[model samples]
Target: MAAATHAAAGRVSGASTSELGAAPRPAPPAIQRVRRRRRPSGEAPPLPRHLATSGKLWLALSGVVLAVWAVVFVTDSIAYVDVADTRILQAVAEVRSDPLTQVAEVAGGLATSGAIHVIWLVNLVVLVLVRRWRHLFVWLVTGLVVVNLTAVAAAMLQRPRPFEVEIIGRWSGFSMPSLPVTVLATFLVSTLYALVPAGRPREIGKWVVCALLAATAASRLYLAQDHPTDVVTSVVLGVAVPLAAFRLLTPNEVYPVRYRRGRPAHLDVTGARGAAIVRALQDQLGVVATKVAPFALSGSGGSTPLRITVRAHPSAAAEESCVFGKLYAATHVHSDRWYKLGRTLLYGRLEDEKPYHSVRRLVQYEDYVLRVLWDAGLPVPHPMGIVEITPEREYLLVAEFVQDAVEIGDAEIDDAIIDQGLSVVRRLWEIGMAHRDIKPANLLVRDGTLFLIDPAFAEVRPSPWRQAVDLANMMLVLALRTDAARVYARARKQFSDEEIAEAFAATRGLTMPSQLRRMIRAQGRDLHGEFLALLPYQLPPVPIQRWTLRRVGLSLITVAGLALAVAVGVDLVGSPL
Candidate 1:
């Protein structure tokens, strides 16, 4: 009936009867789709508050107690005298015949010198297997220090071991903190760490270790080999020293637990490898660097590679000093291979990109290229020498730092600056080379001369298209920073109207350097409109075939890599034989 009435009304209103007669369609069902959370790259979970502060408090408290104990031991103060040793020894002597005492004696005997040595060997093997270098270092150093400090403390106090019961085998040293108790506690802590990774397993392992530690400390007191106070102090030192050392040495970002150690080091300027490079530079370059410091930026403003500045004293007789160094490392270099491969799969080809082959080789190649440019009298940083930290893992390039130079992007760009930048492009092209990464950051102005900084992207006998990219990139950088009219005007002086058009045309399907692309995207304002407006001719956008032969080849390579990875995994896991 409603349909009939609706049809009559539609006829009256000159609407189609078919629409009115049609059955009303049911509403689409709502979907309860699940969405996974996405965190920004390199983001880490926030450290818990207790983990951030607890270690320090524990360290301070233990340190204060130890200090008070040391003062009493040293000054022979009447307060808190050696009565603890007598009382504890008397208590333990009464329990000498108990079954628990016999059990503790057996356990203590098992935790002897031989057993402790075996435990250390086992811990070492586990740490090596897991590649826990940082943990291994902290474990070894803390153990050695604790042992020595305990010995020193016992000797200084000249405390005597308890004689209330049958003495443990070969006991001669004075007992301030029980050596066996200290060794057991520290060994348990370090051993559990090396054996288990963080998770439920580790949490359970930690509790087990804590129980073992308490038992071992109690055993020392039960056997009356040391006073109750001695065992208590030994346990405190064993735990506290490593905790303090961890807090001091390890970064909180790497580990959630404040005093947790054994994280890979973030190789920064202050690391062992970095210091070695600096020393190598001094020897090879024959210039003693009075001081080496990290420059706040050394890049184009975006997160490019990091460079270090060194203040070198050329001669002992001279007071004259100079700043000279190189842009050596970037955070990307650490994971460059995987990053480059992922990018290749997404984007067609990264031809101008650094060799995804290996970081050391890439760095070495850059050093070599910089030397070549310097030898050719091209305006670049004067090459000092290459510091090989690791043969195939790490490297450092030493070069003359342009002391009073300013980035082209930061500088007051004018017609003169634009002209000079263009001239750099032209000169490179004339010499059968291309500064493939012709970006504003790479171009620096010092004393009215434009000097190129990172020539890592330079290529010899490059294709005509590669040379054209250099031209377009130089123009693009200038146009983005300043007005296009000024750039176009300056460009016209060196390049013809048609030649300028050709340069812009060549950028159609060109693979831009990552740094240049990043800088352009990060710009607050777009320059493409201004660029088009200032163009002498409208060139058609070059059509890029998404699924070309190159892409197909890359796809096959990716498949092979995945297959090989699977095969290696199968081999590692083994068949269910």
Candidate 2:
């Protein structure tokens, strides 16, 4: 984490301001803070960044790689650098022997073009099959950049391989940055990050790869095929560049590279992300959160759900309070866009499901809506302002976590509960807005009061048909806990026969939230059918499959894209370097 943290307000070197020449007139607030805590000692990450410690370390490594490369590149022009490189090569040549030559031959053969190509194809094809677009993109991009940079650097430097030395190992091309070694390193990184799981597996993978790389570099040096500088720079650029790129682009915390498929990309709520969340709430929202853990993840899809326990807000308060937080990252933003795209294809011009541009925009809209609802005195949770975790990449949406409440589906419903649930939609109708998603999971029951949560799908001034779907979904959820006839009888108190009929008419399969639909399937209940029977007269079910030119175009584009991605995965093979 690269955030500024104020230390305990103690003078350094046991000196007071009076003793240290008036403390140099107190540095400007920002500068003073920076001076007090120059190191990223206790700060949480992604803070006005430098992001995570790993990110900073990688950046520093890349800088060192470039600096060393500069020195090696100038070895031919500079006296001392040339002397050092020549001496090292001479010393390596002194140890040449038949046994070592054979060993070099074997080590050189280990990282072959065929092996690189095979590993490359395997990662590409597997990532495609598992729909790991984020990993695949980073893998491909990192490979392309490293390989191209290797070629460019070699050509520009044009340093012939270890001048005036006998070459015992097979080699080609100018060898300032060792093209074979570069490609080997690139593929090793790609394999480890894309195929291996994170944590201990990857940590162990690093040491294993280090041994392999060291052996390969040693073989090249022993064979006198590359300058020591050549192999050194190669390993640095090859390993460090891609390592940094993968860490920054596809952080394991957000996008872990695993074999299991179809699980939602929920961020792990421990380690750096957890500590960052605690600090973010304190720095941004001024709440001292003691613990933050994932809460009811199975019910959430758009963002990682969290239950935050905070300390007292006022001195009078003794017990801690738990607030709910939705941690939205780039993954959730992609999910939102895909969800909206599917909605657009299924129902054209629904006038509600529009894709946001970035994670910030997504969190901003939710926070804004939450604030609006709370201001309007709706039953939704009161939102604490968004806490930025990684600039625009991640954010936390804090709000009231209803204590001792169960999903309306699990709760025992009463007449008042049903009426309150129904009236929530009615109130939205009166306010010219729509809850959009009226599933049981989104509705909660505490005592007799019904609370609405997860308005990520809610819309302002939605179409009457969309609002009708909301009402129908709500009524179905209510009927799931009680009888449909009773729910209908109570619904008539607020909704007229024609309006209720319109809502049921607009409602059908796929119109209801998937959670509600799945619940219905699990319960083996025909709640929708029962409600339709109780209506005054059956209206023809509104057509849900809206076939428009936009839908047709998007469908064609999507199919074409999928086919293209798979085709590329299958056939996008090339020489290792």
Best candidate according to TM-score:
2
Ten contiguous residues minimizing lDDT sum, candidate 2? 23-32
Displacement of residue 200 (Cα, Å) in model 2 is: 3.9
Model 1: per-residue lDDT, tens digit, 504-529? 66674245555566667788545555
Where model 1 places Cα greater than 4 Å from the true spot, the runs are 1-266, 296-323, 327-334, 350-360, 508-510, 513-524, 542-553, 556-577
Worst 10 residues of 1 by lDDT: 22-31
Q: What's the lDDT for candidate 1?
A: 0.60
Q: Model 2: clashing residue pairs?
A: 1-45, 46-51
Q: What is the C-alpha RMSD of each candidate to the true structure, in Å?
A: 22.9, 14.9
Model 2 has a clash total of 2
Computed on alpha carbons, the lDDT of every model, listed in order, comes to 0.60, 0.75
Summarize candidate 2's per-residue lDDT along 9-120 as a digit string, tens digits.
1212123222222201111111001111122556544433343576477568768878866875567544455567778878888888889789887887646677678778
